[model samples]
Target: MPHYLGIDVGTSAVKAILADERQNAVAEADVSLTVSRLHDLWSEQDPEAWWQAVQTAIEQLRAANASAFADIRGIGLSGQMHGAVLLDENNRPLRPAILWNDGRSFREAQELGAKHPELSHAMGVIPMPGFTAPKLLWVARHEPDIFRAIRKIMLPKDYIRLKLTGAAVTEMSDAAGTWWLDEARRDWSDAALAATDLNRQHMPDLVEGSQPSGMVRSEIAAQWGLQGDVVVAGGAGDAAAGAVGLGAIEDGSAFISLGTSGQLFVTTKEFSPAPEAVVHSFCHAVPGRWFQMAAMLNAASCLAWTASLLKRDIGDLLRETEAAYRSPSNVLFLPYLAGERTPHNDPYARGVFFGLSPATQQTDLVQAVLEGVAFSFADAKQCLEQAGTPLTYAGMIGGGSRSAFWARIFASVLDVPMVRYQGSDKGPAFGAARLARLAATGEAPEAVCTAPSILETIEPQPQLVELYRPRIEAFRNLYRALKPEFVRA
Candidate 1:
C-alpha cells in the first residue's frame, strides 16, 4: 500500500510522520530546535537549521519504518505562520528568519495600520508585529542592505518546500497570515504589499492547501529511498493545518489549539474580517473556507517555563497540582510571558503573579499558571464571540491537549463542551498527512477529511464554572491595572 509523508516545521521542533492509506500514523520522528532571542522582543532562527532538522527527522522516520517510508507517494508541509524568511537572488537566506512570536516590529506594525486604515479589512486583520509584512517593513528600516538584496520571501515551512521540491509557492491559509493576501480574492494584494515597499514579484506562487504545488525532486527521492513521483501539497499555517487535521472544514466547526501559542478557531463559509476585535480572519486550509481566530502568544509554554523555573518535571508538577486542586487559585497569573495578541495586542506586557502571599507554595504557583492560560483562552472566547462567531463547543488539539486537567479548566472557564479526539495531540503533522493523501490520490476532501474517532467529551462543571467566574474577572482587571506599568517599564 502507498504511504504519505507529513512534515511540520514548528517553532520548537521539526516533526515528520508516515501515514498509511487509512490515515493512521504508521511512524514518526521529531528533532528539536531552538530559537534565538539575542535582544528583547526579538525571536529568530536560522533557516538552514530548519532544513537540517527536517532532513534529520525524515531520516529517523525512514530508519523506524523503511518499507513505509519508501512507499510514500506524496508529501505535505505545515509550519509556524507569519515568519519572514528573506532570500537573496541565489535563494540564500539574507539573515536569520524573524519568527511569528517576534515583537521587534511593533512600531512598523502600528505605522502600517495607521497609514493603511482601509486595508485592514482587505488584509483580513490589522497589521500586527507578528505578521510577515510588518516584519519586512522593519527589515527595510533597520537592515536596509539586506532589504535591498531581497529577491524573495517565504514562510518557515515553505523554506523547507524549497529544499524538497525547488518551488517557490505558498497556499492560501499560510499566505493569509502574511498581511499581503487579499482574503476575499485569495491572492496577494498589491496595495497591501505596496505599503511595505514590496510588490507581487517578491511573493511566492499561491495555491489552495489541498492542491499539488510541486513534485519531490529526483535527487531527494533517491536520497530517501525507492519512490515513484511524489507530489508536494500546498500545506497550511499551523492553525489551519490543525483544523484540517481535526476535519474542521464546514461552517461552525471549531477547535482550540493549545500549542506553544493558543488559538480559539471557528470556521466560516465566507471571508469574515474582524480586525477591531483583534481576531484573525483568514483562509482555511481546505478550499473556499475561512476561519476566525482569537490568538494568544502564550499557552502550554507558560507551564513549561514555570516547571523549568521551579526545577520540576512538567508531568510531576501537573500531577501534584491536580491532586492539590480545590477551588480557583487565590493567586492570579497573567500569562503574557512572550507578550499578548488577542484583545490586548500589547508586546510590552510581561507575565505577573498578582495576589501572591507568603503562603504561596510551588503547587499554588503551578495551578495559577494553568489557570492563567485558561483565563487567557476565556478572553479569546469572548473576542471570537464579539467577532460574531460564538463557539458552542470546541475540539481540542496540540501538545497541551494531553492533559485532562487543563481541558477541564478550559471547559469550565469557557462554559462549553470540549471534545478530545484520538491522536489529537499529533496536531498539524497528522493534518498535513491527510493533505498529502488528498494530493496523491486526487480524492475529494469531504471523503478524506473526516473527524477522527471521539475519545471523550469534557463538559463544564457547574460548580467549577461558578468558582471561575470571579477569578476570570479578576484576571482581566489585573491586566488592566498593570497595562500602564507594562508600558512604563
Candidate 2:
C-alpha cells in the first residue's frame, strides 16, 4: 500500500501524519514549538526552530512505521496563516518570523487602509496587523537595515517548503492572507505589494494549493529514507486545508475550526469579498473554488486560560461546564483575548466578562467562556450569510470539537447541525496528506477529497436556540458599548 506524508507547521507544534491510499492515518507524530513574547502584543518564532521540529516529527513517524514511511510517495504542507517570513539574498532569514498573533503593526495596518482604500476590494481582506503587508511596512519603518536586505518573503508553511524543495513558492490559500494577492485572479497584486514598498520580486511564485510546487531535495530525501523525486504539493494555509480534509471543497460546503484560534469557513463558487464586515474572501485549496472566512484570534485558548485562572485542570473545568449546560449563565464573555478579526478589526479589543455577580461560580464562568466562543462564531456566520453563502450545517474540526457540551452549544447558537468526523481530528495535516495523494497519483480532487466517515452530528436544540437568541443581541451590544473603551486603552 502506498503512503503519503503531510506536515503541518502550527503555532504551538509541528505535526506529521502518514496516511495510506484508503485515507486511513497509519502513523502520526508531533513536536512542540514555542512562541516568543519579548514585548507586549508581539509574537515571534524562529523559522529555524520550525524546520527542526518538522525533522523531529518526521523521525518519530519513521520510528513508528518504517515501512509505511519509506513508501511515502508525496508530501504536502499546511501551516498557520498570515505569518511573515523574510529571507535575505543568501536564503537566510533576516530576523525572527513575525507571527499571526502579533499586533505590533497596528498603526501600519491603519495606514494601509487609509492610503489604499481599493486594497480591501482587490485583496478581499481588510489590512490587519497580522497580515504580511503590514508586517513588511513595520519592518521597513523600524528595521530598515533588515528590510533593505530582504530578497524573498513567504508565509510560514512556504518557508518549510523552501527547506524541502530548495525553492521559494507559495499557494493561493496562504498567499490570500498576505494582503498582497489578487485573490480573484489567484496571483500576486503589484498594487497591493506597492503599499509596503515591495513588489512581486519579493514575493514567492504562486500556485494553486493542489498543484505540484516541486520535488523534494536529494539531500533531505536521502536523510528521511525517501525517494528523491517525491512530489511536493502546493499545500494550503491551515483553514483551507482543514476544509479540504473535511471534504468541504464544493460551493456551500462549510466547516468550523475551534483550535487555538477559531474560524468559520464557507466555500463559494465566486470571489465574494466582504471588507466592511472584515470577512476574508480567498481562494480555496481546491482549484476553481473560493472561500469566505471569519476568524476569532481566541477560542480554545480562552477556555484554557479560564481553567488556569480557576486553578483547575482543563478536564475538570470542562466536566463542570458540561453539568451546567441546561442552566444558562447570565455572565457573558467577550473572547477577544488576542483581539478580534471578523466584524471588528480592532487590535486593542480586550476580553471582557460582563454580568458577573457574587453568586457566580466556577461552572458559570466556564460556561460563559464556552458560550462566548460559540457566540463569536455565530456573529461570523451571520456576516457570511449576509455576504452570500448560507451555512445551514458544517463539519466541525479541532480541539473544541471534542467537547460534547461546547459542540451542542455551537449548534444551538448557530442554529445549525455540526458534524464531527472520524479521522478528522488531525485537521490540516490529514488534509495535506490527501493533497499529497493527489500529487503522487494524479487523482482528481473530487474523487479523492471525499468527506471522512461521520462520528456524530449535533443538531440544534430548539429550546436552547430560542434561549440564546436574546443573549446573542446582548453579546453584540456589549461589544458596541465597549468599542470606544478598547480604542482608548
Candidate 3:
C-alpha cells in the first residue's frame, strides 16, 4: 500500500495529499483560490487559477482515495517561495503568478540589487523582484512583448513541473530562492546568468529537491484517478518544504515560518551571506546543504490586521487576550505591518504601536500581536545568529503556530525551543509527504524525517526567558530607530 503524493502549491489554495508509509494521512484534498489583489501591493495568481486548483484538488483526492490513487508511488512538490512564474513560446502563461506576497517588485528589487553587486557578492543573492530574477526584470521592463516571448522560467513548482512532467524543472529547494542560485556554487549563477541577460538556455533544468523528475501527465493521470506510473519528485521550497514539514532537515535545526511572509529557517553547513546583505543564503532541501534564511515581511499578517481592526475572532481575539501571556506589556510592536524584510530590507517599514496607552487592552492588543510576531521573529533570529548560524532547536510551522498564547510568545521571543506541529497537514504537505517517503525507500534525510512523527514540543518558559531578554533589547532598538524613517517612507 505505497501511496505518496504531496502537491501543496499554496498561498490561497491547491493542496492534494495522499501519503501513507509512515507519513500517515491516507487522504486529503484542498481547493480555495482567490489571490488577484489588482492593486495594493499586488499579488496575482491565475495560472488557469492554479490549474483549476490543481485539477480540483486532484479530483477530490482521487475520489476519496479510491484504492489510494492506485498505490501512488512517488510525487513531491512544494511551493510559494518568491514566486514569479513566467513562460511563453507556447508553454503558455506569461502573466499572473507574481505572488510571494507581491510588493510591486520594490523598484524591481532595486534594479536587481543595483545591477548585481556581483549577484550579491557572488551568489549570496540579488534575484529580487520578489525573486525569479527580479520577476524577469519586471517582465523585461514592463512586458516587452512579454519579454519577447520568453521560452521558460518557472516557480510555483516550476510552473507545476511544467504541468506535471512536460518538465521544465527547478529544484535545489526551488533553486535556492532564485536570484539565480550560486549559493556558493550549488548551481547556475554564471555570474547570475551573465548578470541577468538570464537565458541559461532559458533556465529550468536544475533539479535535486529529492529526485525523479518525470512521468505524471498521461492525460493528467487519467484526468485525476491516477494509477499510472508516478515519479514526480525533486520538489521543495515552501520554506524548504516547511523545513521538511517541521523536521528541519538536521544541522542546527530551526524553523519559524509564520506564513504570508515570516520565516527564519537557519540550518547550515555553510552558505551564509549576511555581511549586511541581511540574511538569505539558500540551497537546502537537504541534499548537499545550505540555508540561512531570515525573512519577516510581516508575521501572522499583523495579527490578521489586528483581527480586522478589532472586530474580533482571532479565536475570539486570543480569548480576549489570554492574560497577555502571563502579563508584561508596556507595549511596543513594530511588526512592520508591511515593509521590512530580514534585518531591515525596508520596503518602507510601517507597522507600529510602539508603547500604546490608555491601559492598552484587548489584552494590550493581544500583547501587541504576540509581541509583534515575537519581535519580528526576534529580528530573524538575530540574522541567523550573526551568520554563525546556530539555532539548535525550533521547528514551529505556520498559520502562526495556532497560538498557545502565540506559542508562549514564540517560546519566550526565540529564547528557543518551539518544535511545534499540532499536525493539520502543515507546510508543503508535511514536506511533500516526507519527500515521498524518501523517494520510496532509500531513506535517511534523517530517517525520512524522523519517521514522520514529531507532533508536539514547544518548551521555553524560564520566567518567559526572564521576560524576553530586556524585551529583546527593546525589539532590537525598534528596528534601529525605525531605520532612517524606514528608508524615507
lDDT for each residue of candidate 2 in 342-436, tens digit (9 for 90 to 100): 87877788899999889988888999999999999989998887786788898889878887778889899999998988866799999899888
Per-residue alpha-carbon lDDT of model 3 for 1-489, expressed as tens digits? 787888888776778778787677777888887777777666788777777788787778778878877788888888788687777877888788787667667787787677666567455654444566766777678778877787777788768778878988878867777777777777887767666576577888876777777778898777665675888877788888888776667666777788667788867776667636477878887687777788766777788778888877788778767844565577877877657767766666777777877766776876776787787777777777777776756766777776666777787777777766666336777687677667656577876775234667778878868877787788778778878886676
The deviation in Å at residue 488 for candidate 3 is 11
The superposed Cα distance between candidate 1 and the true structure at residue 328, in angstroms, equals 0.4
User: How do the residues 1-489 of candidate 1 rate in per-residue lDDT, one tens digit apiece?
Assistant: 999888999999998889999888999999999999999999999999999999899889988999999899889999999999999999999999999999999999999999999999998899999999999999999999999999999999999999989999999999999999999999999999899999989999999999999999999889988578999999899999999999998999999998999999999999999899999999999888999999999999899899989999999999999999998999999999998999788888999998789999999999999999999999999998888988899999999999999999999999999999999999999889889888888898889889999999999999999999999999999999999999898
Task: Assess each prediction's global lDDT (C-alpha) against the native.
Answer: 0.93, 0.89, 0.74
The stretch of ten residues in a row with the least summed lDDT in candidate 3 is 121-130
* Cα deviation of 29, candidate 2, in Å: 1.2
Return the lDDT, model 3, position 77. 84
Give every collision pair in model 2.
none
Best of the two (2, 3) by TM-score: 2
In candidate 3, clashing pairs total 2
- Stretches off by above 4 angstroms in model 1 are none
For model 2, the stretches where C-alpha displacement exceeds 4 angstroms are none
Q: Could you tell me which residue pairs clash in candidate 1?
A: none
Scored by lDDT, model 1 comes in at 0.93
